[model samples]
Target: MKQKIVIKVNIHCQKCRSKAMEIAAVADGVISVAIEGKEQDQVVVIGDGVDSACLVKRLRKKVGYAYLVTVEEVKPKEEKKEEKKEEKKGEKPTCQPQCHGYPYFVHYETVDEPNPSICSIM
Candidate 1:
């Protein structure tokens, strides 16, 4: 079955982005890789039978710090729109426990070299 895997990687430059894409491209089942979100921190991968844990490990080793955000089965556009409509009608969107059952991970890193209080989230 096809799945959409969204991962958060610590990308700081064009080189980092290129490395991230390269690592993801050579992954076992990655059909495509793209950067998403306003901050361009989310890497979206679409493929069949993609292993989330292995992909995260590869990214961490080759790209930088990486974390699994979510792994979800791909859905048709009409089904996705229906789910969105249900969300708008007060239904909570169901979350699949793909990140080892964790809701989310908070990655803390220093924003500036001299200041500890200046922090960023990934």
Candidate 2:
């Protein structure tokens, strides 16, 4: 049976909302999702047999966002490192021939103190 789940998520801006949408859209059994209630941001996930716990876990791991419950839970230590890795990818990574089939970039080398790290854009 399908269900409407209103999760108290920390959806701050349009970008965040979009990321949440992306995560929810790909999740199994998720028919639809939307961020509603401007006064109170509510992420509505509509799906059949959606595993709320697992869905929340994937959201934080894959999207780099927190799933706000009664109170914010400390993100698992391992996930914190994963988030940092994703951020580094954004800073220094570019398309390599191997990445043609995927939406990813090749990470070259890192810079030493000061000068901004450079990466060839695709």
Candidate 3:
């Protein structure tokens, strides 16, 4: 079951808020964690089978005083995708690949072998 838990945490600064968010994120079955509320002191955690009480306790111990604002079941939203038309064999597809985050690497260099030898370990 998918659940959304909103915890009101006493976040005084950026560090406290980040710590609270980090704590909630590392919890078991957590899908997403976001700092919310008007004062940016609430931590919103969405996940499957998340322990709300334990999460608040961890925040209280690590960050500051914390309490459960709300715990409720959330329904997943379904998006409608447009169907693509049949393309000619020579034509390129319209869709383009997108990179979400920083690329860990640009390209890998392939080392050409000058000679091949049988393994002697066997």
Candidate 4:
């Protein structure tokens, strides 16, 4: 059974990211480890029968605070791509939105809390 596990960790620096990757790579049943996210805080591990709890624990002990975010069983990439291609073959390409002498803007009140409003001027 193949599994994809995502873990969120409080990674602060390059060294921390390196250590986190190393720790995740050595864990039992981990086939591959990839660091994701802009902050390099999300660890994506894909393998067969990977132990999520144990991997999280090891990361916490070796590379600071870490927690499991998600675990999903996914089909092989080739199968997924083939399915996507078949689906796309029947779909028409959509055109990009065009702005015709109009101002478009989004306003957010707070950084921590996202309250977005779109404003348009013609």
Task: Give the candidate number with the greatest lDDT.
Answer: 3
Candidate 1 C-alpha lDDT tens digits along 1-122: 78999999999999999899888877766679999978998899999877789889888988888999999998755555445423256745543333445567798986666655644773
Give the residue spans of candidate 3 off by over 4 A. 79-122
User: Candidate 2, which ten residues in sequence have the lowest lDDT sum?
Assistant: 91-100
Output the number of the TM-score-best candidate. Answer: 3
Per residue, candidate 4 scores C-alpha lDDT tens digits across 25-122 of 87666678998987779999998877788888878888888889999996875555445433446644543222234687998785663775665762
Colliding pairs, model 2 = none
TM-score of each: 0.61, 0.49, 0.63, 0.61
- List where candidate 4 sits over 4 angstroms from the true fold: 77-122
- In the range 1-122, model 2's lDDT, one tens digit per residue, is 65666666676777877877787776666667877776445677877766667667766775565564431222334455445423344543432222124567788997687876676783
Give per-residue CA lDDT, model 3, range 10-115, as digits (tens).
9899889888888888787788999878999889999998888888888888988999999999986773465433456885443322223456877879997889
What lDDT would each prediction earn against the true structure?
0.81, 0.63, 0.83, 0.80
Judged by whole-model lDDT over C-alpha atoms, candidate 1 comes out at: 0.81
Which 10 residues in a row give candidate 4 its minimum summed lDDT? 92-101
Q: Tell me the lDDT of model 2 at 118.
A: 75
Candidate 2 deviant stretches above 4 angstroms = 68-122
